[model samples]
Target: MDFGVTPHDGLPLPPRVTICEVGPRDGLQNESAVLPVAVKAEFVERLVDAGHTVVETTSFVHPKWVPQLADAEDLFRAITLAPGVRYPVLVPNSRGLERALDLGVRDIAVFGSVTETFSRRNLGRTVGESLEMFAPVVARAREAGIGVRGYLSMCFGDPWEGEVPVPRVLDVATRMRALGCTEISLGDTIGVATPGRVAAVLDALIASGIPVDSLAVHFHDTYGQALANTLTAVRKGVTLVDASAGGLGGCPFAGSATGNLATEDLLWQLHGLGIETGVDLRKMVDTSTWLAGHLGRPSPSRTVTALAGTS
Candidate 1:
């Protein structure tokens, strides 16, 4: 577990992995308890001070679907942008992208799923149809000189559809690349994967010649397998990971699904193994503490709770 020292060389890892904190969007979106807009902004600022470079601020989705994030625009505008840090918002389509662009967002993430059944249920479009629709969206963002990231949800098992084929996941990744998405994040939407399965999926994707460096992993902790899956992806050369503070979110569509891996837990694991995240653990725990207070529930992160003496 010592990433700093190997069993053979006893030397530290050359570089640590980068973590993309998505609590503001993915974490907050599914909370049944609504937090004040100002509070949400405060939580985001705290995360920045805690050393997160990329904080997913909010999503431009409709409030009707996700009532928890009704104040997406206001929250985005209110957040104190940290120096040397990037705030990426989740923009579903042209409308979402336009809203972000109006708010002066420089980087935005467009989301789509890998499975046809999940795609139709979650996005109201087929996988191919979604890719075709993103063509112009990516074109507009590129013309505006904005950075674009594509998210492929349900990369592992799906609730609606039992298990997702690796080939199907790769096909979606290939389409995202073709749509001008520089980064493709494979999401374990239902958290139904183990390390061996994670390696198999990424291996299939990499074997198809997709640059491993261009891939990221987003996992849920439904089965408490997200961390193991993340380690597998890291060993496979994936450089970016998506996590949420306090593990505060869940999927609305995926039944009984949980939030993304807590930022604190992942950092704890990474730091224990000598992986440098550049994040302040104490500050992250503080933010999670405050956010959990707003929701009147303890954080789902074992690391956060244990450190806060609330577990």
Candidate 2:
């Protein structure tokens, strides 16, 4: 576990990276099958056992919008919350926030879109309107001693809006920070971002006085550039990255969107680069393999596919 002297493009990489595993929440939300609440709880426990310190548990969105995770409250109650590990759930509005607070949840995430079209389509509000809606939720969470993680989706590209400008992404991110979000995860919803594009976006955010420590990269594997783009972000001093266990979920709003960057795939790269993630790759692969069976499909992760001999 010695992360010794790993440098990329002359930039000193972090000795350890904090990976927030999004499998239980983001990964399963888009699946067609509704997994039992107990199964989802087991999935979260397995991931934490594999050394993921931060695991997104579930979303409090209306069951009508995402029927798959309708059991968010039950799943949250079922998880055996480990000491020193964070279990953040996605809260779309004040109602969601109220539900999480009722369960005594400490960490929660709010999602916002950079593009107007996507904001309206996904959340049924304009970009400004959605931010306006999240403002009170963020404020209320802060008042209740809860930490808020902001998710800025469609940071690189969007299906309806095409390519999104860096400033537009930065604007929403800045607003989230101003609204009391502890960290903002920049999401490549369509997975079209390359290394250069990732570098440019990170550079812009850093140049605008947004500390790299306050940001996390969430890349999708749609065009298979997720790992490369993530590497580019790490090179730019991004210490936090988001990945799913089995590369589980896709964007319901974006037609061409695919699963997220797999935890096993990202762990392989991090371990190869001598960066400490504290994750057991084999265990993670096994967890994904187990969950894949429930979904009745093979894991979308390259590392899992290779290790499980399913390729």
| Candidate with best lDDT | 2
**Candidate 1, 192-258: lDDT as tens digits:** 9899889889999899998988899999999999898988888788879999999878788877688
Error of 2 at 28 (Å): 0.3
Best by TM-score: 2
What TM-score do all the candidates reach, one by one?
A: 0.94, 0.96
Q: lDDT tens digits, residues 37-129, model 2?
A: 888888999999999999999999999998898998898889899999999999999999999999989999999999998898899999889
Off by over 4 Å in 2: 1-9, 309-311
Off by over 4 Å in 1: 1-14
C-alpha positional error of residue 183 in candidate 2 after TM-score superposition, expressed in Å: 0.5
Residue 38 of model 1: what lDDT? 85
- lDDT against the true structure, per candidate, is 0.86, 0.90
Please report how far candidate 1 places residue 250 from its true position, in Å: 1.3
All-Cα superposition RMSD per candidate: 2.4, 2.2
Clash pairs, model 2 backbone: none
